[model samples]
Target: MDGLGFTVDQMAEAERRGRLFGLAGDVLQWSGPPIHTVQSAADELGLSAEEVARVWALLGLTVTGPDVAALSQADVDALATWVALKAVVGQDGAYGLLRVVGTAMARLAEAESTMIRAGMPDIQMTHTHDELATAQAYRAIAEFVPGSGT
Candidate 1:
């Protein structure tokens, strides 16, 4: 037994969790690029710290600090997309969309966590341990949506 007194099964399960956590980026399709700190993202995007903070909050998260590399490449890319969208939708409209999407995603995440905690398969609502690719998951969602016109 290890010093922590964890059984062999427990140790193996812990390692499995660690590996899955590491692959979360690939699961989420966050393969655009590496990330930067909040301050660096703000300066690079020509946005203010307050503005960046707001975006972080809208995504149902809080930035620990300006120097924390907590944001991902997709996060920065979304900021750039926001800038372009703001020109067309205006700030209020953009924030509205962000709020809706963020809240929806948060609920989905909670449901997923609950399903996992129950030791049930949640991916595509199947009972297999198959890992899902981000693109495949997106397509599944699109296909499931009624009147999505896809």
Candidate 2:
């Protein structure tokens, strides 16, 4: 057993699964390393940090402090979209819509994760255990489902 009390096989399996998840994140385009802090994003968009945090909270995401570099390009783009939406719908309506969409998307993401996990074959059964092959299989399954991950 390793230091964590996991067997070698368990560790290998965990590593393989982590790689697959990383590949999936890459394919999704929204999992890039964060490059913008809340303050930076607010400065770029000409909004106060509080407003940015509020929008993020409305989208079902945890609101980080202004200095945390937790916002990726996709996040900033989404925030920009929210700003535009708020312009049209006004603050109250925008918040309502964001809350509803965030909840629905969260549910959809959960369903998609379940479906993908179900669809993947057991690594031991395949006897391949190759990262490339596993990643291709994961990508195929992820793309096959028409959900938020796609």
Candidate 3:
């Protein structure tokens, strides 16, 4: 599957990298598999679908349709946090805080990824594209980073 100026080999390499990195998802505290749809998450959290979508959009996430199972446990926790904050600060205040936090977190993630990529060569000096080596390097790096407790 080649598109967007990426040759088939490039796409294949990306897929390999993604598969290797996916093994580090738990260590990285990345979201788990999708466990809820937008409507389900809203219903479980005692929120309207629109409210959930709005919060997601404010956090720089794509707002999926009501029936799409695009939300994970981490996503649900975030929505729950939004609900709690909204109760204390009202919707607008919660939105403002979410916007600030989201932007900051996004920037931090970009910086971290850049740093990690820069360090990967030293981390796995011999087997650059070896999946197991790459995954191990990622897990080691993630272990050193602080957890977000999401």
Model 1, residue 133: C-alpha shift (Å) = 23
lDDT of each: 0.62, 0.68, 0.71
Task: Give per-model TM-scores.
Answer: 0.58, 0.62, 0.67
Candidate 1: lDDT of 124?
31
Candidate 2 lDDT by residue in tens digits, 35-138? 89888989987899888888788778874567878888878887788889889989899899989988987887788667666766632225446665665566
Ranked candidates (lDDT, high to low): 3, 2, 1
Error of 3 at 112 (Å): 1.4
Off by over 4 Å in 1: 1-34, 120-150
The most accurate candidate by TM-score is 3
Listed per candidate, the RMSD to the true structure in angstroms reads: 9.7, 8.1, 7.8
Candidates 1 and 3, the one with greater lDDT:
3
Candidate 1 Cα deviation (angstroms), residue 35? 2.9
lDDT for each residue of candidate 1 in 97-150, tens digit (9 for 90 to 100): 889888987887677557543653333324434444432343343343234211
**What is the Cα-based lDDT of residue 75 in candidate 3?**
80
